[model samples]
Target chain A: MRSDVLVGAVSILFGMAYTVQTLHLPKAMVGNPWAPLFFPLALGVLLVAMGIVVLLKGLRHHPSSAKKGGSKRLIVVTILICLAYTALFERIGFIPSTILFLGGLLFAVNGAKAWIVNSLIAVTFSFGVWYVFEKIFYMNLP
Target chain B: MELIQNLLLGFSVVLTPLNLIWMVAGSILGTILGMLPGLGPTTGIALLLPLTFTMEPATALITMCAVYYGAMFGGSRSSILLNVPGDGAAVAACFDGYPMAQNGRAEAALAISAIASFIGGLIATVAFVIVAIPVARFALRFGPPEYFMLMIFALSATAAISKEALFKGFISLLVGLMISTVGIDYQTGVLRFTFGLMELQTGIDFVVVIIGVYGLGEVFKNLENIASGGGLQAIQKKFGRIWITLDDWRRSIIPILRETPVGFLVGVLPGAGATIAALMAYNNEKQLSKEPERFGTGTIEGLAAPEAANNACSVGALIPMMTLGVPGSGTTAVMLGALMILGLQPGPLLFQQHADVAWAVIASMFLGNVACAFINIPLAGLLVRVLAVPPKVLYPVIVALAFVGVYTINFSVVEFVLLILFGLVGYGMKKYKVPTAPLILAVVVGSSMEQNFRMALMLADGDFGVFFRNGICWTLFFLAIGSIAWPFLSSRIKLPWNRS
Candidate 1:
């Protein structure tokens, strides 16, 4: 359950998966046989070897304490909010989605202090930025 | 004589009204952004890249370089006033700067920092100009094999020098290079890692990764800190005086002079940047000081050396990028990306082909340093007020800006999603104490490395020994091996000396 071990295991899995994918690439007709696959395959093997070393070191060392409960929950909530905002970005429109996203983030961080002020800021920022980008810069904002 | 003429041409280009205004504007904006917690020059340049899309290449490049200079100056302000480093490079500044603020000499600290920054930047710019011309000429002889070896040296040096565990650094680099391998393989006309996704066919955009990793990732970390009640502290408003006395000047001058070249040389090396330069300069100053113990207690020399080193380093990083087409830091890599976006290639040919753009950029750096120092010194009091805006309010706006910046670049939904994904990954990397610089640098140079690697092999008819056949390539290969081995060797060698 050590962090290094987890990292090493993930790396090994990724390296193996990448090696398999590289093997499946169609061969080239000309140039070196090692052209496309050479660099990646070598990297994969190096990765696996390093992962094993890290895994061994991790097993030998003491595990560090895990992240705090509240921090973890907050990070999870933030990620979910960001995912929702991204999913609804075009559908809800830039202004509405951005306002909601900003307002939600503000509330999440500060717990609803000065609700009117937060709302004003959220609206102004979303609209102001949208205007600058769309109207001034001529970037199309969905 | 040629240098003088080129500089005159540069000055003429930069002296235009619009370009001058852009330079000043970039300085102001970059200073403010760099003063913000967790946002450095890289983020400042990345966030503002979309605005320059419509401008001329020379104008766009000048603006970005000005921002780069402004950010370096601004970084010292936060380190001096609040003891919070505005960026990684400013960490050394905090050692002596915070103590100065604590000792009620905040104004003196700020003044000396600005002055030292100006001197360092000026000297480094001069050095960059001197080094770049010959380096570019020398680089003209570089074939594919030499380029490949240079990139390998860069990668290895980056991995070895990063503060993280060496293996972890290499792993982070491998991750980046692997990401670069995604999309259609150009030579074979085959999709490598597309996995049937239309978006994957083009691979991931570097800007998207940058925005996600540095911008949004920083936000996520700040959010957790805020939730944990570990947010920004209220900054002290009373700055006594904006001037350093003659005695203060006397103490700072020598350290500033001594650290400039040290910082510049460090900056010239690819992958080792301002952070290392500042740390080394600070340490060297401490060693040479009569009062070594006074270093962490806010001595003027302690404050000056690192500030000078880091600011000088900002200019030092440009030399390799301009002359050899290799970025020396994350910020330089972003600037390199900016150059490519503006339809200009950096490298030896840049000076010959786009002399106007190159010279203007160089001239703008000179102008930017003067502008930033003047602006920073007079406005230090007002700028520190930016720290008053709590994380709760500021981070949300930053997140919105990041999204807007990324969206404006290509407006691809998949890229935006990739931004979020990398942001989380970047957060995880930070949590695990893995350095992100090498990873970012790898992504920037990975494609070029691959191209040069293949080209070298093709030219030599698949002979593996072609990489070491030439002296330049052989030297670079050894340098790469040496850099990677140096850390381990140093640790082992120290044992015997310690015993003795």
Candidate 2:
């Protein structure tokens, strides 16, 4: 469906914002007429052009379906899980949150017997990774 | 004599107990990961990169190379026994490998893949050793202007590789470049695309982007079709007696020999990685085969050619990473990231200053590939059993792993959001048939290309013609032109503007 339209439109708006921002850089300090800003500015222009193409393509692919899909409910739920995991990682810790988040995700996907298996696997994998990073590699993990 | 001395020093470092342990660990992990569906070397390396923070650069690099080469050797396991390709490079392997498995020749397929991989790796290693020193010296001659031209070439080639319409590829490349410019500008110190958000000042982490694109995107894509039924028969391929018959060896040997150099050289080129080399090798082999019709149905040559190409390409990828500091493949990109994290800037100067380290990495790759061949061939059956794991169970785990990996990078909530957003973008790009490789290549090569372009301009005193003035630069430019023109030239898409 034209689900990519809004995303492409937002991208074009961001590109415009970037182009306006690039204008403020001092060209004199940039030296040569091409300057450091040239490539970025050029990219911004191309981004807007590409965004427009994407928008048009998306619209043509689905004039009405972009806004009408209950399946997209899953997207919101997924996003929330991500946010919850992010907000909770340092507090609840990476291993706990990762296993819990994975359990929830698998459950949502109708995983049946796979949910418990996934939970165990997630706990093991996350802790295994954490142990390697923090204990062995001495990385300061969240 | 100098080479021998440096190599001996490298061997000393690589053979250290700690590094050897890391190499074995990396290879085992890599083989398992490659045996799984959807995950590739990129995910394996990226997920491991954050852990490399404490290891010495030489150890980190050798470990990463081990994983990369091990994955190449092991990816065929899934393709040969389960019909599921482990990665893009292995996609061609499925054309022949799976049928061989179904025909009860899985052992033969696995055996030929190991031999081909070993041969390809060996040839590419020799080429790497021969080419690296001279190439690093030659690349040292590049001034900012030359660097700029090279970057532009990388960017242009990346943008053009997309299977989508040129305009869409341009958009994806532009988005990457724009994302790259979001942080404080190198010259002006002007913040870009930050929109007053505090987190934006640091720019989006490359880890976040990669995890989103490769890891999370994979999860979402898998979710879209999880209900689709597929069987996971215990890889019943007879295990212990793996060996290609004389007929099998005869068919594969010639193709492996032909594909190694082709794959290696293509892989050595900046931005052309194992995936391309594998695809090109398969296509070239098919074109040359008297029984081209047997390609997709299951041919040993198809299995051998792409397997050889992937391993050759692994070695080929090291050429630019070691010589020019430009990574030709995603695994090498992570290796570059590891090097950068170690505060070791790799370039022409790197070879002169750290010959021992550079040569050690090269020497370790040689040993690692040999190690992978020995280790992987015996474990192919066990690894192929990875397909028995239901996708339903695996997808969520992959997503969780990706989330945790990115979150650990900085404990930033914003980066997590960025991961989901980029995953959606990646999913969208996939749906539209837009190639993600170009966008990634652009992102990886983005900084160098931009820096070089501006340097070139400054060196020429702002003369645009300077890009064309040098014969080498002009040749590169024309090659870019040729790359652009290639599709239309080969296809029947006649364009008036394409007239020579």
Best-performing candidate as measured by DockQ: 1
DockQ of each: 0.60, 0.42
lDDT of 2 by residue, B293-370 (tens): 898777889889988988898888788777887665556766776687687878788889987778778888878877
Residue pairs in clash, model 1: none
Model 1, span A63-125: residue lDDT tens: 778756336666777777788888999898898999998888777765686688789888999
Q: Please report the interface RMSD of model 2 to 1 decimal.
A: 3.8
Steric overlap count per candidate: 0, 4
Among incorrect, acceptable, medium and high, the docking class of model 2 is: acceptable
lDDT of 1 by residue, B1-500 (tens): 99999999999999999999999999988888888878989888988887888789999999999898888888877888778899888888899999998888999998999999999999999988788899999999999999989888888888787323787778888888888888877787667778888988877778888888888888887777777777777788877669899999999999999999999998888777888889889988887888888889989999899999998888888988888898867788888877877888899999999999899998988899999988888888887788788878888778878887888777776777888899998887777666677778888888888889888888988888989888998899999998888777766664321221
How accurate locally is residue B372 in candidate 2, as Cα lDDT from 0 to 100? 81
The reply for model 2, stretches above 4 Å from the true place, is A1-14, A24-36, A51-75, A110-115, B162-165, B227-240, B290-297, B493-500
Q: Of the candidates shown, which would achieve the greatest TM-score relative to the real structure? A: 1
Q: How high is the CA lDDT of each candidate model?
A: 0.84, 0.74
Task: Report the Cα lDDT for residue B128, model 2.
Answer: 87
Report the C-alpha lDDT of model 2 over A1-142, residue by residue, as the tens digit: 3545765686699789778878875453434533557887898787887788778877787466333222444555666777787678768866677777877777766555665666677678778877877787676665
